[model samples]
Target: MNNELTFVSWNVNGLRACVTKGFLDHFHSYDADFFCLQEIKLQEGQIELDLGPEYKLFWNYAQKKGYSGTAIFTKHEPISVHYGIEDNEEPEGRIITLEYESFFLITVYTPNSKRDLSRLDYRLEWEQRFASYVTELKSKKAVIICGDLNVAHLDIDVKNAKSNIGNSGFTAEERACMSALQKQGFVDSFRHLYPELEDRFTWWSFMAKVRERNIGWRIDYFLVSEQLQNHIIEATIEDHVMGSDHCPVTLKLAIDVS
Candidate 1:
C-alpha cells in the first residue's frame, strides 16, 4: 500500500510492427506498473506475446479486423475493466478503463480528425463523450487518463502553430475540447510539471524526416483528476525510446493508498 506507481502510455502505431522493432525490450526496461498501448491495429489472435508472468494483459480490439485497438498490461490486476465509453455506441476499441483500488486508469486512442479535418465534427463529439466518461469515473476514484489524444492544445506543442492553426491535430476546436476537460477539474500532468518547456513532442509524422528533425506534436498526455495532482512526482516524454511515430509518455506518482 506504500508503493510508488509508475505508469507509461504509448501509441505503438501498430503493435505487430512495434513488437518486431524492440517493443518487448522497451517494455522490460521500463518495468512500469501499468503499461497502456494504442493503435494496436490487430484483432484477437493476431499476435502472441509473452509479457512475463507478473503482468496481466487486457485487450480491446475493434470489431473490424486490423483497425483501431488498445490494450493494457498491468502488474496489478484491476478490480474491474470496461471497454469503450459507458454509452457503448462507439465500439472501435478506442478506450479501456481499468478500475483499481485507488484510481481509475483510462487509456484512449483518440480519433484523428484527418488532414482536411473532414472528421472534425465526429472527433469533437468523441471528445465530449470522453470527457463525460472521465467525469463519471472520477465519481468512483482518482482518475488517470492517458495515451494519444491527437491534439496539440497550445502553441508550444507544435512546430508551426501559426501555419497549422486549422490543421488536424492543432485546430482551435480540438484544443478547446482539451481545455474544457482540464477546466473540468483535470490536470495535464506533463504540462503541469514542465509549464515552460518546449520541443518535447510525442507523436511524429513518418514523412519527410519529421522525426529526425524533431518536428512533431505533443499530442499524447497523462492527465489526472485535480485531487490527484499532489500525488504526481514526475511526468516525462520518452522521446529517445521509440519504435513508432509516437513515443511513450510516463507518469510517476507517490501514491500511498492503504
Candidate 2:
C-alpha cells in the first residue's frame, strides 16, 4: 500500500492546561494522521477528555502525579502499542512505541537535565537506552521518532548560544549525543528538509517575554531512519499555531501500508 501520512509532535507543558488554552482546537486544525504529545502531567483519573469518535488515544502517565507523561492520538490503529522501552521499569511514562504495518513510531519525552544539571547523569543514561531502543526497532521496520529531545543540537538551534553553552539543553555533551544519533543514520527531518533556516524554534521559555523575542530552542524533532528519509515530503515548524510554550512540529510523508 502507498499513502501519505502526516505526523505531529508537541510538548503541551501540561495537557489539562493546554485544553483550556485551546489545544484541542489546534489539534483539529492540524488534522494529522498521528499526533504525539509530551508533559501530560496526569494520572488515570486526574483528567479526562472526549477525543471524539474517530481517534484512538493512548497514554503513559507518570507514577508520580502531575509529573512527566506522554500520549499518542492516532487516526489509524496500530498492530500493537508498547509503553516505554520495557515493561517493569517504565514508571515515568516517558516513552511509547506503536507498531504500524510498515513502520514503528516511537514518541519520547526526554528527561530534562534540570536547570542546575542535577539530573544530567540520568539524562545521559536515558539517551543511551533510547538510542539503543531505536536502533533495535530499526531492525524490524522504518522508524519515526518524535518528541521533546530536551537538547539543542547546534548553535543555530537557539538564541544566545554562546551564553547558553553549558545550559542543560545546550550542553556540549548533550549536543554530541544528538549528533551521534543522527550519524547513526537518523535524519533530523526538519533540518534535513530546510537547512540554513534561522529563527525557527519549537520551544520557548515561559519566563518573561521569551517567546516574543524568539529566544527559544528547537528541542523538539522528528527523526527518521535513512530508508524513510526519501519518503518525507515536508517537515515544518508550526510556529503560528500555539497553545503551550512549545509549538507543534509536523512531518509530511508519502507513506502508506495497508
Q: What does the lDDT come to for candidate 2? A: 0.91
For candidate 1, write residues 91-187 as lDDT tens digits: 6899998888888999999999998889999999888888888998898789999999999999999987898888998888999999999988899
Cα deviation of 4, candidate 1, in Å: 0.7
Per-residue lDDT, model 2, residue 87, is: 76
Error of 1 at 106 (Å): 0.3
Candidate 1 lDDT: 0.90
Kindly list the per-residue Cα lDDT of model 2 for residues 46-101, writing each as its tens digit.
77787778899999999998999999999888999999986767789999999988
Where does the lowest 10-residue lDDT sum fall in candidate 2? 45-54
TM-score for each model = 0.97, 0.97
Model 1 TM-score is 0.97
The Cα local distance difference test for each model comes to 0.90, 0.91
lDDT of 1 at 102: 82
Q: What is the lDDT of residue 181 in candidate 1?
A: 94
lDDT of 2 at 7: 94
Best by TM-score: 2
